[model samples]
Target: MAKPKKISTLNQSIWPYLSPRHWPTWFGVGIAWLLAHLPWKLQRFLGKQVGRLIHKVSARRRNICLTNLQLCYPTMTQNEREQLTKKHFESMGMGFFEMLISWFFPVEHTAPRVTFSGEALLKETFEQGKGCVIIGGHFSSIDLCGGQMTRFVKVHPIYKLQSNPVLNWIMERQRERTFEKTIERSNMREVVKTLKDNCAVWYAVDQDYGRKASVFAPFFGVNCATIAHIGKVSRITDAPVLLYDYYRTETGYHISLQATPDGFPYLDDVENAVAMNKMMEKLINSKKEQYFWTHRRFKTQINEGDKDPY
Candidate 1:
């Protein structure tokens, strides 16, 4: 038999397709819309089946989830971690399809299925006439949370580019449909300029940033690679930082919005920004299970020659 060709890296092949961002979302939304029209019981049954498929296919990702879960929650038993890991993957699989319809197809069509709580935070921040920084993590239905906020404020989120061109192009287009504007990580200047305009800058600083752009922040008592750009953004723009998270509830999605500085205080310096980021880390740890533990967040191993201190 002939040797099979190896697949190229996603960055090289699929990054281009995601730049436009809307068309692929439209594609996903179309599928989601159809799924929504099905009988309620049937939709749920299909969702569960999809979740199982995700577990089966992403074997490596499941292992990473287990490793992270154990590292973050050393107190939990192995069986407990295994169960939660399965639940996390199942929730994510269903959430992905649900969001496809909610964010892309039509707001009126899908918004009713879920409800938001901290809507006032968005309005209050926008009314202040100063830009605000909304920080969130890679949780289930994170896109839905950001999409809902867009209803009140023109949110410009910094999104990491995807490796698959076709999939990336699809998602970028989908996101643009809801967000006021979209910014990529490669353009640092534009991100700064966006905040300078008094527009909200949404950043998900939950993942690794290698060694250069990262700092060793205490996550579950271990030094985890945390990005410093979020703190930098707050320092540079003097934007009020808010901790935001959206999780799945029995009825729908519940958004938790917390305003720091106790209503209003001077947070105009890098030191203050760093302090605020520490608080964010603690808030994330409070609900460890709800976070996206499957991600290779601590993948960056520190080298001996590295000069940065934790």
Candidate 2:
């Protein structure tokens, strides 16, 4: 039989990726491809199992998660926090599968499985002829739901470029295929340009970026460094910034576009940061384990000499 012709993108040849050093990455990708083909329930089961393995092996990861939980859930007993830490790792493993599924799964089959609870709000905002800035947090299933969102409305996601060339190519290509466009996380200019054309841009503000372009705000129960760019962008472009919440349901994946509290884009930077934190906390409160808790969220302190949490 004749050999099938190989396919490659116009920008680059597959020969480059086939190099020996890239083989390990390709092998890992191949494993992920196989996992992507598994039944949904089975994939999740295996994902949880992988999470369990990581939880048992990575004490540093466990400690980070535990510390975050300790700061946020002060009322929970140590035993409860420990249990939540394990569950959070399992959630992280599931997040890995969710990302793969977003990239590799059949969109025709998977897109329908997503349910946008506040789709009407999404439509209503677009009708006003204003661009939308979606403010979201570091949820486990963010990419999973964000990919599905394209089926309903065009959404340009803000992403940080990955360091690994092969991995970066794979992710960028997949995101290009899934979203209207993938704007670099640092490229606020491009983000504004896309919005100026009356489009949607998704951004996250929950992580600690230290004091620069940030203010100390109460996240959960602890005051941490928080970015207030969401408000500035909204003010710059006259865009309506809405809260985006993502999670899973028994029937399918779920997402919401909640209207930001009135008087957003406040002139006071601290006010904007406080409101952003409150909104994000409300979203994460719905599902504790679904949020990315292993991050060193409290790494930055309001006072210069305060002890670090992690």
Candidate 3:
């Protein structure tokens, strides 16, 4: 019999994070704390400059971004694609600072900059004692915009645990505060429970999760490996699937919701996955640069021995 994977829980105590090996982590946190307090505009400026530097230095990630854009935007010229890739790095840079600002400050400070709609849409599900699943893409302003969401509606989010325990704890701690609850991406049992308890769970279906969970679907005109489990969950729980998104606006951020198009979760898994992919494509269309291009979205392929297109 195979051993079950032990889920990592949020440990609230700081004592375990105090060892000498964890000193660097603490040092980085102090620096982030200081940066979080800098004037917002200055922070954004620094983040962009740093992002430019990251684009130049992080060759592997840069290559992945370039390749993804190449695969998705066949109509775009190479030069145009390069320019957009640079801009995406810049968004990532600013997004880092925006995320810090989200983490350190109270909602009172950040709420004014964020404009959210769809509370009533979400409330419609809550009123019936049914859980909702918020389907979204990986937008660049996820952290900053996510932090502001508690002011409107609380959504339990699905996230992966980082290898670094301290970092995971710190992130989960903040998410617990911001989202009301944080469920591990692998914990489907918990996700089912959260929905049945009459709450919302935010999930992004844009990344490669291997062949078992994926059904190849059309994305930006490519047959990309798209995760199919959203349909399974919605089908089982009878939860309404709503489009969720957050993006950087000139002033601050905007978070909104939309109803998923009809026939989203057809009884056929491939049909269901295709619907999810279309929903993600719809969100990405509005905020092209702000989408998470850093992810290797095409790591999986239908071919038996195709090279992993990093």
Candidate 4:
């Protein structure tokens, strides 16, 4: 009989420093590190498997995805909608692996795989000596896409703090490698200052932030509570607003930047919010599966009588 293989003792030495609660987090990081070294195609294949598993087990999130799909694509048949949801989950899974790749792998490795368009616009905006607000909607490939943007322009990304300290630390470290500065989402003064310094600020405004600083705008024909800060920031800094969006393609990742119309935030807050939503809608329609559908985009109801969709 063959001798039993000895168990690998690689991480055993660090076991003492980790609490029971932290083991899972570290285990996940370990897996992500391994995944990061794999070929992009293979990593994406494994990510699809992971996504399918999550879709099978995560009933709440699965339902939310389905609900969003239903709300957004009302005319589609049930079968078609379900297919899109599955595809979206697969893309989400790939996005997870891509996030690992973005943080751990060198930009040179991905540089060949990405094609950037409209970089001249970014350069032009920078030359103008007023800051630029790069607005984008949440997409599955966002992390990797943002990583690629760093190669073209030094941007200050505004991010929400993760609840997990270890994860947050790791993520911030990774972002610091690319971004000139990382500002907390709540730090409006810092954001304004960054803009005033003629730096690029990357902001994603698709998530639901409730009604306080938000206006009801139509996203996929559904009234969504959209954040109003994009216009406010632009007005305050007197900076130009530009839309930067990305999606995966057969060749590789495709990133594009386009300036918003002159006099954006025209008329009123509602109009500005509507314009932003329209831009998001166009990007989502380009590659529906890559859009971040799992988010509760329509969480906040427009009125008391309006029913919660998720």
Candidate 5:
């Protein structure tokens, strides 16, 4: 692996005053900080409990997850789908602790738990001097997996703005500790500029963003809204796009990196979006229980007659 670059630090002076609405955010952060100091095994155990509790109480999110599973795995029996949903919640529960570990602990402490494969692909792509875009689906262990990647390579991560300013401030501070930079999800100008400068940018391409600024594409055999900007950005920057995915094993975490199909995004925007969804499907299928299914992936419809799955 190439030597990791020095992380550029950002000012962390945006602490907001505690208000009624902000109390939950602050309390959550406080609890996470305390949990970060616990042993990994214990933390994982606690996370499983938390996740199980959430699955019982969070009806709306639970329904969304089950709806997604039903759509994507129509052949599976209801019993099988329900079991998968329960496992997914357990994985998500563990992910909460993983995020705390990623944010509060030093990279040296967490590095031993994660193993990497196919890194040569990333190194070769970086060596080409056109820059690289590392894309992945939204998995439960995403935050900690990205933290592990930062130990080996300098990366700028694209992030959606959090609605809670205090929470976002703290989250960005944690990310700045590892990533070369954190780019706002909507800042395409910076994304292009970073790639043009031969820097790697990490993007998670799976989610529902409504009808506008999306292309109707096949995801899990159903037409769903998919982002079409990746092809346009790749065309602008001429950067090689790579697929990276991480999953939890019985022992620890495993991360894999591979180059995308040759001449990808050479096709039109809709084709590119279709290709992106196909790639995501391949990875998500490998660890179906770890994929983020709480959000409605099939929220947007191609026609007015199509009903909302959520």
Candidate 6:
């Protein structure tokens, strides 16, 4: 008998099937395409329906959101947490259809969907000649921010490839249209090459990390395995680290950008990385409602007797 494969982020068996590179991905694309062809009124209606269905079907996931919210926002009432959770899912549905159409449909259609703030921040960073390390959180409309950022400065998003070949092709094509380039995950050499060429690279750090490769950091009062790559890259390449994110607004979505303290004065120390990660946590914490709390942020726990506060 064959040995069972251990489940890891790398072996997320569902990715091959659910990924944008697969046939199932095309199903989502096809639905989005059809929705795009619909009249605006009908499209909005369909989106709302999809959003309702998403909430209905994701009961367990909703509970997870509630749990995460309760942990993060202990002072808030249950009613408030539930309301935010519902809004997150509703926005998620709208975002899903928007992403589908954005990825497959014409770019012009989705261009008007976002309103950008901190436009000058991006331009100023690019003018400095040094490469930038853009850190994004799992907030609202990340897909839109990725597309919109390309309008100003050059950005190379460090993306993990989808196992589904069909969806991967669609996503790769879409991202390439918006950014200067895309770097596949685990491709350290390519990332280095991009930085050497004086180009900015973007990364989302809201996911788990390997034990040996990460420092335990407190995100919402929980110890999560967080990557120190941004600090390491800054130390090596001296790139300016910028915190960038998008959140839903009454008008539309807004892209907020700000500079993070780079050149961590104590480069040869582990504390520098930990400090940077904590700073990131503060930024994400300030916008608790806009955060992707559904993610299993604390999936990794500190080892026994480890005095880590994260």
The candidate maximizing TM-score is 3
Ranking by TM-score: 3, 5, 2, 4, 6, 1
lDDT of each: 0.66, 0.83, 0.83, 0.84, 0.84, 0.68
Write down the TM-score of every candidate: 0.77, 0.92, 0.93, 0.91, 0.92, 0.81
| Residue range 76-141, candidate 4, lDDT tens digits | 898998898899899999999889988897677789989988968987888989889989988888
* lDDT assessment of candidate 2: 0.83
Clashes of each: 13, 0, 0, 0, 0, 12
- In the range 1-310, model 2's lDDT, one tens digit per residue, is 8653433232675678789998999999999898888988887888899999999999998899999998998999999999888888888898888889887864566777777777788889888777898888997887788887777667898877665667766877888778767787778889899888888998888988777868888888688999868778888888888888888766668877889988787988889988888898888888898888988999989898888988
By summed lDDT, which 10 consecutive residues of candidate 2 come out lowest? 2-11
Q: Stretches of candidate 3 above 4 Å error? A: 1-9
The TM-score, computed over Cα atoms with residue i paired to residue i, of candidate 3 is 0.93
TM-score of 6: 0.81
Compared with the true structure, model 4 gives a TM-score of 0.91
Which is better, 1 or 5, measured by lDDT? 5
Q: Candidate 6 — which residues are off by over 4 angstroms?
A: 1-28, 38-45, 262-287, 304-310
lDDT of 1 by residue, 28-138 (tens): 646766775665446555766787788889888888888887777789999998888877777777666666555446455545555655667766776766688877677
Give the per-residue lDDT of model 6 (tens digit) for 1-310.
Answer: 8653422232234445464445565676677677767664565556667766877898877877787777667889999998888777766666665566567555566567676667777778767777788777776567766777776557788887665455565677777676667887677777777777878788887677567667776666666677767677766776777877677665565666776665452454346546555666786666565567677666566784554322
lDDT of 5 at 125: 85
